[model samples]
Target: MTTVQSARGPLDTADLGRVLMHEHVFVLTPDSQRQWSDEWDEEEQVANAIVKLNELAAQGISTIADPTVDGLGRDVARIARIQAEVDLNIIVATGVYTYCDVPNFFAFRGPGIIPGLDDPMVDFFVRDLEEGVRGTAVRAAFLKCAIDHHGLTPGVERVLRAEAAAHLRTGAPIMVHTHPGTQTGLEVMRVLGEEGVAFERVILAHSGDSTDAEHLGSLAEAGFLLGMDRFGIDATLDFESRVAIVVELCRRGFSGQMVLAQDAACYIDWIDPMFKGALPNWNYLHVLGDVVPALLERGVTESQVDEMLVGNPRRYFGG
Candidate 1:
């Protein structure tokens, strides 16, 4: 009976037979859709999300982490409804995302950037965890934050600090959206370590995008969970290359800290209607049936797959 304890309660690892750590449920907003260049009606958007979730459920994926933050339409009520309908364990997030432009609310109140895990903001996150997400029945099981490619801006640093504060309060774990080949993941670990937060409680997301095996090895050695979540986005690099990186990392004796997911969202087309280019396949079964089998053919073992897909995620999300 493989099980990992989450802040919500104990989660059966068997229930999460195969899981995707980085994904979104329903994030439709004018600003978010600007990348797509067209407006979407709320009903259509919700229906699209339902279609995707149903697809995932049919493919044998038992759990998904929808890492959308507060302002990005992190609709907990809607997500809970979908979870009940689809019968999938949907873990949501509570934190803020980092962008070059700070929101007006943050700008008006600040001479300095607010730390993500700071006093009032930390209180807000803790309150959401204690009460309910967005005043709905769903509760956030993880804290999501981001670091830009160029190192932490003062604004991002504030958010990272706030994330750390939330970890201190709830011990729910933190997930970072990092730029590939950047040291921002390392920097996040450094800050969290300084704050007395255990490295095991932080997930360095998108670390696989970088071919720098040494950098990833170092983070894994430091005890942070490494997220190789973007599996099938092949325009920049093919699936083989991504699996090669994971295989290489395992060869270097760092399999213990690795996790895998496709990170494909159906809304990519909505976000960028101009992105008519080939998109990675979002079907979870394709990954489990095809991608994993291909990796196995390339000499990657079932154990390594288990480490990346099951063990590391179970540990990071506390199952």
Candidate 2:
């Protein structure tokens, strides 16, 4: 079995104080430096992340969980550096991302004609969790997976199976990325249930995109953590719409089952080119500092914010 440890040493979740459940420190596209164009560089990326972390710490955020899975260029060593520099608890994740984003090898030949919960790949996840990620002293505290917007693709389904097996072997919580406004969360929960995984050990990401109260309420009632992150992506839906879904969920007494984040990163060219004239817009901390406080002003209670930002994440990450 894979036994995971916190990267920031031992932590008391009760004193986790305030936390940001999902955010990325450094994110790189597949083509490496070439993919980033003129605005991307390692040093600049790290510096921007540090500034954001400091800003979040000042705003009462004591911990952060960066769910940058394997295909996402999750740099645990750099994360460790940021943690030490900022003195904020940062938790890193280990596991494969969505099949589309993963390398061709993972999607093609492997165990069970897909990335099954068997053999070498399973060994890979187990080793990373038991030892450390990429030979760094840092370790992963959670496992991350993703389901496509339309539901589980063949590649995605295989990844899910691998995740399930990893969960059974490691006892690490699984965080799943689902499509916005889709019923993918339910499908993910169904698969996990079939694999004999407990709902409490899984977090349904992007649950906020779906405003279906009954669906979200059902997931909460089923004992799963609902992640309503993606706070800064205004292109798809505005913050108010997303906050409304969360507020409605809170009203339905599902506050304790929710986790919040602004899944923003410092990929300069990835965002709309018009913003900052192609410079990296790693200003998610600004959103947390502004939007979350706005939610408070609009009657989202401090206790509710605490549940979404702090308490729920501690429980979800099994801190």
Candidate 3:
């Protein structure tokens, strides 16, 4: 049986039912929080996360593939604590999350910086997938990297290449936080393709931010899973447009090539908590309560919904 690692332990991939391809229990700037913030309360935050995730599980979401890694402030031990209180399967990932440069931790070591040295990120990522993350038993189930509008700087390229190398070593599928507005997915195709990583195993996240159907179709046809996530974040692209694009793609027979998510998190330290009120539906249950209803009302069949929410994610993880 093919199994995938979750925050709790290894579970049969078949058990990873109704997955939200992208979601986070928490997204923190640990350094900033430690030094400059007094709002963070470990006990309260952990309890809040359990309450929110339990609500998601009660909504029938069996798994949430969280891509919170190094740059996003991953804490596997803390995640395991939250997992112990919830019955949901949380699939964590390994890879750096940076748009412009590698973190200073990698600045002088690896590759071009040191003439004869290798990229240590590849080994770290592989170890996270093959063994565990941060000395904890929760092994990462997939690889994640980012290439935003800043494009591929030396640091960005290093992270992407390291992610590809890790994928090649562990067969863990990849998820790239792409900036589709600038068509950065094209860069991902070129780079990962050269690394011998199959496009079918890559997820071009935030593809829903772009309403260019032709561009989306081309990428889907090229075998990359389009993440029509960020459902409730209407600030980038409103709800109507996001739903319309998905309906159109399903009408064009691309449901098999897409995955759905809110990209929501219980707590994100980037934004002011008061500002979060502006995005009321930007939570885990928005997909089930709002998006699915909107899709069906707009003529998306139940089978197409299943393909995006269930089958596509399963296939992504080799279930």
Candidate 4:
């Protein structure tokens, strides 16, 4: 049986039931927070995360694929701490997160920047997938990167190429944060396809944000897994529209090509606390409490929901 790495340890893929394919334990910019934010209380935050995750577990979600990697402020040890107090499987990831440029750590180095150098991120990503992240036993089970409305800039291309290289070496699946409004998923297919990465193994995250079923269906036809993730963030598309798209896709017979999630986090330092209040339903429980019922009411079958919530993720992880 294939095994997937969890925050606590390795688990057989069969055990990853009803997974939220995208979620984060925490989203922080440690440098910025240290310099200017006082909203963070480490002990309290960790306890709060424990409460949140356990509550999710009680709702019958067996696992969550957290894409909080380097650019998103991933802390493996902190995840391990949270996992210790919760039974839910937390599958973490590796790779950078940026819409335009690679992080400055990668800026001056790497292949084209220097005459004889190789890109270091590929090695780092593969190491996380095969070995362990930062010497911790919490190995990354997948690779993550992003291309946004900014399109594929030099740095975005670098990160995608590196993630593709790592996927080639380790057979790990990939998840890309794409801006569907700009149809950037096509660029991902062209680039990663060039690297010989399998389309089925890559997830086009935030696919639900765009209600164009034809645009989404084309990607599914190309064999890429569609992440109907980002359920709670209604600022982009409202709740009814989000549920409607999934119903239409399921009707069109692409249920096996999709996965679901809220893209929620226990705490995110990106938004101002005052502004965060406007998104009352943007939390970890949105999918279980709201989206699923809506999908059912819209005539999405139980089997289709199971495919998106369970079987698809199992296959994505090589179950």
TM-score of each: 0.87, 0.88, 0.98, 0.98
Report lDDT (Cα) of residue 11, candidate 4: 93
What does candidate 3's lDDT look like per residue over 1-319, in tens digits? 7888899998888788899999989999999999998888999999999999999999989999999988998898999989999979999999999999889998888785885578999999999999898768889999989999999888888889889989998999999999999999999999998999999999999999999999999999999999998999998899999999999999989999999999999899999877989998899999999999999999999999999988899889987
TM value for model 2: 0.88
Better of 1 and 4 by lDDT: 4
Put down candidate 2 lDDT per residue, 130-207, tens digits, no spaces. 678885787787888888665777667777877788878988788898874677887887889899999988888878
Better of 1 and 2 by lDDT: 2
Name the regions of candidate 3 deviating beyond 4 angstroms. none
The per-model lDDT (C-alpha) reads 0.72, 0.74, 0.93, 0.93
Q: Candidate 2: which pairs clash? A: none
Instruction: Give Cα distance to truth, residue 216, candidate 1, Å.
Output: 0.7
Candidate 4: stretches off by over 4 Å? none
Model 4 residue 106 lDDT score: 86
**If the candidates were sorted by their lDDT against the true structure, best first, what order would they fall in?**
4, 3, 2, 1
